[model samples]
Target: MVFVTAGALDGPLLTATLRLRADHAPPGTRSRVFAVGAGLEITAATSGTALAGAAAGLPAPVLLLAVAASHAVAGLLHPVLRGTARSPAALSEATSASRRVQ
Candidate 1:
């Protein structure tokens, strides 16, 4: 069903998101970062469920379009947000330095 398909699609995205969070979090704060990320994800899911319930009467096409639009916005934002993060070279150097210290 559609729900199963959606859940399957979400698997890789969730994994990548967690990996990215781990990569970006400060060395001593990875657990806190993951906890915060999970809490936020849960809050967002709850909010989305409430919104969907409230919009239950809306036409299916309209809801679908809204979902598509949100996806498009997220896709566009990804590059812009990524640009603000440390580059891969910097991250590798930091990792190497940390390994040396350990």
Candidate 2:
């Protein structure tokens, strides 16, 4: 259950990061993608082991709260990973719609 929750929260963010890197990388260059994969692999291995160690002997509610807090921190960092905002055209459309609503 913890793995499933974490995966659901992380999958799309990781996918978006990969897609963004792929689109911006040089044509025919897969090095960036590989780098991202390697980083994720390393992070998962170390963090998973550490988390498991910490959660051991902890109360179930405490572990769940820790997981939720970690996800919340990840959520906060997601916007930075998202890079720039939408294009001016999209921004203008959004503004116009809001103006109409007002």
Candidate 3:
């Protein structure tokens, strides 16, 4: 339990630090993408270890599977979400629609 707590804390703390670094980085989509990946990796790695430790009562293979799943969800899932938000023109579509309504 204690181990899990200590290790689990790694993700959020690292994420906050990464966010600050990301903010200071060049203002561009590339920076934003990097920041997101850094955060996700930190979270997945931290949480993966924590969860793996807690899996003592479970089967060994199960532990590996869970940790891998967590990593995938963190690293891959977030980039997809961020990717979908990339279309700057989508916002303009809303503005054009509003103009037409007015």
lDDT of 3 at 26: 41
lDDT of 3 by residue, 25-56 (tens): 44435477686877898797898778666777
Worst 10 residues of 1 by lDDT: 87-96
Q: Report the candidate with higher lDDT, 2 versus 3.
A: 2
**Model 2, span 49-77: residue lDDT tens:** 99799779999999999889999999998
lDDT of 3: 0.73
Alpha carbon lDDT of each predicted model: 0.89, 0.78, 0.73
Say what the RMSD of model 1 is: 4.0
Q: Give the Å shift of residue 55 in candidate 3.
A: 0.2
Evaluated with lDDT, which candidate comes out highest? 1
For every model in order, what is the number of clashing pairs? Answer: 0, 0, 0
Per-candidate TM-score against the hidden true structure: 0.69, 0.50, 0.35
Better model by lDDT, 1 or 3?
A: 1
Candidate 3 or 1, higher TM-score: 1
Residue pairs in collision within model 3? none
Clashing residue pairs found in predicted model 1? none
